[model samples]
Target: MNDTTRTVRLSVDCMGGDHGPSVTLPACRSFLDRHPDAELVLVGTEQALAPAAGWARCRMVIASEVVEMDDPVEVALRKKRDSSMRVAIQQVKPDGNGVTMADACVSAGNTGALMAVARYLLKTLDGIDRPAIASVMPNQHDGFTTMLDLGANVDCSAEHLLQFAVMGSALVSAVDGKEAPTVGLLNIGEEAIKGNETIKRAGELLRAVSAAGHINFHGNVEGNDIFKGTTDLVVCDGFVGNVALKTAEGLAGMITSFLKQEFTRTPLTKMVAMLAMPMLKRFSRRLDHRRFNGAALLGLRGLVFKSHGSADALAFENALNRAYDAARNRLLDRVHDRILATLQALPGAGTTAANEPPAARHAA
Candidate 1:
């Protein structure tokens, strides 16, 4: 039997994004309407969160400061201790009784600040080195391909890539309900020998873990393989993953812009576009980056998702949906189980579970 009545709570940084409460408030209201068993803890300044005061199943956590979009990670982490982003993440931290105020947290603030604050507040899970930003992209099969290390760690070693694969597998298994999803090492070619030494080494580790019945390693995949849906998940360093993500978004934008130009170029083109309106609309929606707005900061003790700062109501709502789904499905537990099961198989891993241990510098 399926359990549909489980209550899931979320702590949202209402003042984190570009539009602040204006966008988040509307999305929060819509999310509450869709999920009756869901609750929200909105964190922000009193003036910013005034509109949500009367919302049922919602509580406001007053934060004195709002971390600016350009605030340095150091400032956000040190100076603004009471920033909304920090406070929202704090909601997911377990209390003395091992109970958290909220099951998960969501923020559309500065990416670096979010990561720093989240790590400072929740810390990394045992057997996990560093947290990676994992999110989905639309694939050729009309499904999503999960990719990680978007921008969390600019430089990642082979061990970090393996850790990302483990965490990503757990995320997909928990949220997408795939027990053993395929994992792909993003490389220049399908062959394992194509990438640099780091990727090549990561491939060997992934294959070893797969042979042990841990993850379903799918060898190496090219840049185009991401959209080809060649595998269930793509593992790459933050630099490469972030570039791939931005390129995909740019391509989507180009397609939309091209369609609009064709529709308004001339009367005949307009008629042609009118006839193809339904198909074009479907294509547009399929490639909309806004539909996939939330990026999970994996390998953490608690759940924290990052949304695009420019996300509108629809996009922010989708981020909320992702966070809610992960929390309700117990993604944290799944990640812990996966890492613990495979920790010993991979050597020199999980040495950086502390906030910023010096030993992490020597991780493979």
Candidate 2:
């Protein structure tokens, strides 16, 4: 359990997302009410932060520019230097007094733009080549499955996948209190010979790391295995992970819509729905995508979480809570130690040119 006495400060991009401050301000209010030891720094234009003017445990940072939801990564990086998104991420850095400005940052802005700005500002953690987006998804076993590379890096090498596994293991261990989280390499099939060259090579690396007592590798798992809770963490390239995530979201929406239509089709069915309203409510809550809106951009030197662009107040609140949890648990430190240990356990792992790549030489 995390220490409840310590305060967790979060910087929020209040002018990002479709609803902008309208959604974020209310969410902040609710989040503050729920977490007494938490503080917030809302970054946005003056007008956008009017609603939160006199809130306790919250302050406003004036950002001149606003990053639109459709803003391109280049535009956000080059044009909108003072955008709310960038300002929020900037708060994650250490101050002159050597104290961290904020524990974490949360934004519901353009995904590509957010990634670009975050990478430029926070940079990657030691032993991390590229940062990956990781989030929790509900599984059939009534527990959660954490999947990574959710649209961060579309193309990845075997080494990148291995890094994702190491990072993902640390995340689940820190956040979920798992001693050694089980990792599954996402593949087309469960067979050892099923994936492409990159996946097969990644599997080999994962097996080696598992043998070294770093991670609990569960062989390979298919797409269905994600929902089956076959493993605590699922590793894949961003392209496949993004597709799987969006597909699951779409399927959940479709199922909800179909159920609504069926229940209202006739008076008898409507009566049955009313009779089973409690069960329906429970089912709807279980499948609500809003409950799982926050996705952590892992492997960064500082913490940054992304919320769905279309997230409402409730959804945004969940994203804030997720960020707060990560900060409170000192997730960054855990990830750093795990990655260092994993790198040390590799065969012939040294700083020599022939032993490892130049980029990975100082990863530890």
Candidate 3:
């Protein structure tokens, strides 16, 4: 066992992703090699964990079942009680001795199922009504922008967006070391009057929080503003956030394919490509999505990060690195503190106020 004060124990679902153990086990090996103070709890079937047996700093937890990439949320929650994914997340829960089994959990599994299991098992933090998925994206300023609700809660209230801003701010602050990260409300335009009633209301709530010395709200921002690094954190409902994220991913893929096609079009182009290989490689490295592979399920009592189901070894390793960083930084505690502070500052708008009288609380 590592004697370092910063040792982080991470639970990994070895059989959850597209390539299963073939991808995750190698990624675990690479992660352990780089993080000497980190330990891993590899959760999967006995046969699936055979390759990881010889790895140092790793302990295997046998699971009898596997959750497929396309399994429905109901099936994962109800049928697969002993699935590798569920078992991995279970490790984040406190054991019979009231001690946390792991610092955090990482999984490249069905997004819906992971969220369902995590929420059901670990539950949300003190003042957060719902959890949001926050991920870092590359920006024009050579820094990263964090965006939240990236497919966790499709329908959100203005209050939910407000809570998301708090959680996103806490996440960026903890992981990126930003003392007070700026927040932007994703909308149709930069003006105050744009977007639906829900967005306008959300903006109002964000401003209120800012005035209360809770968040650094930067008003409204458009889709293009995301790449410009207009704010360190962006908040939106899952429906819109998911659409924006997928669109960006599709555009990146298309651009890469186009460049490849053009470069291989002719011998003349191939010669030019060889001449510019150094510059092209640098550009590719900067925009590679693998560098930002993990998305945190913020607001949970315990930390849980979701990786792309088809992530390769490098990408999976990046996900593990992100989880390790969050755990080391005490992200869960930071989020809880921020939410509790915000609730205390606002008098009648208590934490439970948002959940009670659902219609009135959700209305724009």
Candidate 4:
């Protein structure tokens, strides 16, 4: 290994993804080829995982079942004991013979089940009301923005938002190399009185949370502010944020398609396209949400990441790198101290992590 790089063990769900192991195998192979020290653990039935195992060096974890697209979370966790997703999560138990979550576990499978499994296996940190899904997205200035709760929580409290603020701030710091990130509350308008009651309450809570001198709170920002590079971090409930994220992705795609048509309008334009294609490809990849698809189930006791179900191999590699970064940074330990301290100091902020980890219950 090089001086700047370290090895990271990653668990990949072989049965998930649009093309399953067919596309995933090549992506994993590409990643392993480039990253000599990286190791992969493939989870699925032997039949599904075997082909990939043949071409690349990987551990084949036997998973007798899989959660189909329409399967309910309850049924998958309860009835499907041998499911690929379940077996992968079980590895988090760390029985001394295998890798634990101190190494990260990632899935491009049923997101709900993955979240449930992580919640069950790794558990949440002390005083973290709900763990969030944080996505790193494009910034106009050749950088990225850290946005959270992209479908993790539907309804949020001021307390929950405040907690997200701290975690999200830490995330931007860790991934974006920003020592202190400016946080923006995603609202209808860039004003305090613009959002609904829940958001308003969350806003007030954010103000109080910011007063502690921890997060650099920038008050409110509209969805349009994301491209303006107005803030380093954007915070909101999963529903609105998820919609906004997907919309942005669709918009990016549409813009790219429009540019292609524009460039194809004439023979000279075609020459311009040929010359600019490489740069455009790089720019498009940089802006693709899936390029930054992995989101840590923040506030968890150990490493747990959720990637886009539609993620490809490049996206998988990105997720793996992200998980490695989170674990190396000791996110769990930091979150524990920050959350407990924040809660203890706040009004009605009163829960604590139990003696036993939440990994078991969330799994169920």
Residue-wise C-alpha lDDT for candidate 2, range 152-183, written one tens digit per residue: 99999998999999999988887788979999
Candidate 1 lowest-lDDT run of ten: 355-364
Model 2 stretches astray by more than 4 angstroms: 1-4, 95-98, 349-364
Q: Model 1, 1-364: lDDT tens per residue?
A: 1345667889999998899899999999999999999999999999989888899999899999999999999999999999999999998887655578888899999999999999988888887889999999989999899999898888999989999999999999878889999999999988777989999999999999998888999999989999999999999999999999898788878877887997989999999989999998887788888988999999887899999999999999999999999888788877877877677565665544433221110001
- Give me the displacement of residue 69 in model 4, in angstroms: 3.0
Candidate 3 RMSD to the correct structure:
5.8
- Candidate structures ordered by TM-score, highest first: 3, 2, 1, 4
Collision count of model 2: 0
Higher-ranked by lDDT: 1 or 4: 1
Residue 314's C-alpha lDDT in candidate 3? 98
Number of backbone-clashing residue pairs for each candidate, in the order shown = 0, 0, 0, 4
Model 4 Cα lDDT, one tens digit per residue, 1-364: 1123545566666776565676566666776787676677778888877777565546778888877756778877688878877777665555443336325566677777777766776566767879888887787886778888888898888778888988888777666667679999999898899989878988887777668766788999988788777999999888888899889888888998898899999999999999999998897777777677787778776667776777777787777678656644555545565566566556665745333332221111
Alpha-carbon TM-score of each model against the true structure: 0.93, 0.93, 0.94, 0.85
Query: Model 4 shows how many backbone clashes?
Result: 4
Evaluation by TM-score, superior candidate among 2 and 4: 2
The candidate that achieves the highest TM-score relative to the unseen native structure: 3
Cα TM-score of candidate 1: 0.93
Judged by TM-score relative to the true structure, which candidate is superior, 3 or 4? 3
